[model samples]
Target: MTDQKSKDPLHGITLEMILTQLVERYGWGEMGRIIRIRCFNNDASIKSSLQFLRRTPWARNKVEALYLWYKRETAG
Candidate 1:
């Protein structure tokens, strides 16, 4: 068997890592504006945000997309 996840950029990355980086770069207030989830809108913690994101696919997709964009923006 082969690892199929090697082709994915986010394969090895954890949701907590993604949220941490976004929060570090943009902060909770900005993340709320960008994502508008209750987790990001209220007392946003990695545990809370991860729970919400795991249950909500749409919101999770938005977060992943934003993380990718953030990575590109900061790459330069």
Candidate 2:
């Protein structure tokens, strides 16, 4: 079989990378507005967001959803 991780989208992708890209594209103040999660709204940073997102699946899904939206919006 091929490299096992090659088929996985989230594999090797750290939550910090996700949050950094999203923050770079939109900034934390606005990202919080978009994602509406306390981690993004409170004293947020890559560390805090990663902690929250890793433990909370629903919030992580929302963050991923926004990342998808950002990808689509910027791709065009």
Candidate 3:
């Protein structure tokens, strides 16, 4: 095996890390605009967002996608 997780971009990344970075880069206002989730809209916190994202696959996917895009954008 060639380290299966190596092929995954989110392999070693935690949900909290992703949420933190996204908030740092975009802030709640923009993040809400991008994902349209209530968690990011009203009273947003790492804890609330994490709890919501954990239960919501679609929203989590959007968050992950944004995180990946953010990483690529800032890389260059």
lDDT scores of the candidates, listed in order = 0.91, 0.83, 0.94
In Å, residue 12's CA in model 2 sits off its true spot by 4.7
Better of 1 and 3 by lDDT: 3
lDDT of 1 by residue, 1-76 (tens): 9856587879889988998999999999999998888889888888999998999999999999999999988888
**What is candidate 3's lDDT per residue for 1-76, written digit by digit as tens?**
5735477899889999999989998999999999999989999999999999999999999999999999999999
Candidate 2 CA-lDDT value: 0.83
Candidate 2 segments whose C-alpha is farther than 4 A from its true place:
1-12
Question: Model 1 RMSD to the real structure?
Answer: 2.1
TM-score of predicted model 2? Answer: 0.80
Ranking by lDDT: 3, 1, 2
**How many residue pairs clash in each candidate at the backbone level?**
0, 0, 0
Q: Comparing candidate 1 with candidate 2, which one achieves the higher TM-score?
A: 1
**How do the residues 1-76 of candidate 2 rate in per-residue lDDT, one tens digit apiece?**
7755576556687777888999998888998888788877789889888888999999999888887677788889
Please provide TM-scores, in order, for all candidate models, with all chains considered together.
Answer: 0.88, 0.80, 0.92
Error of 2 at 43 (Å): 1.1
Best by TM-score: 3
Ranking by TM-score: 3, 1, 2
Candidate 1, position 36, lDDT: 81
Best by lDDT: 3
Clashing pairs in 2: none
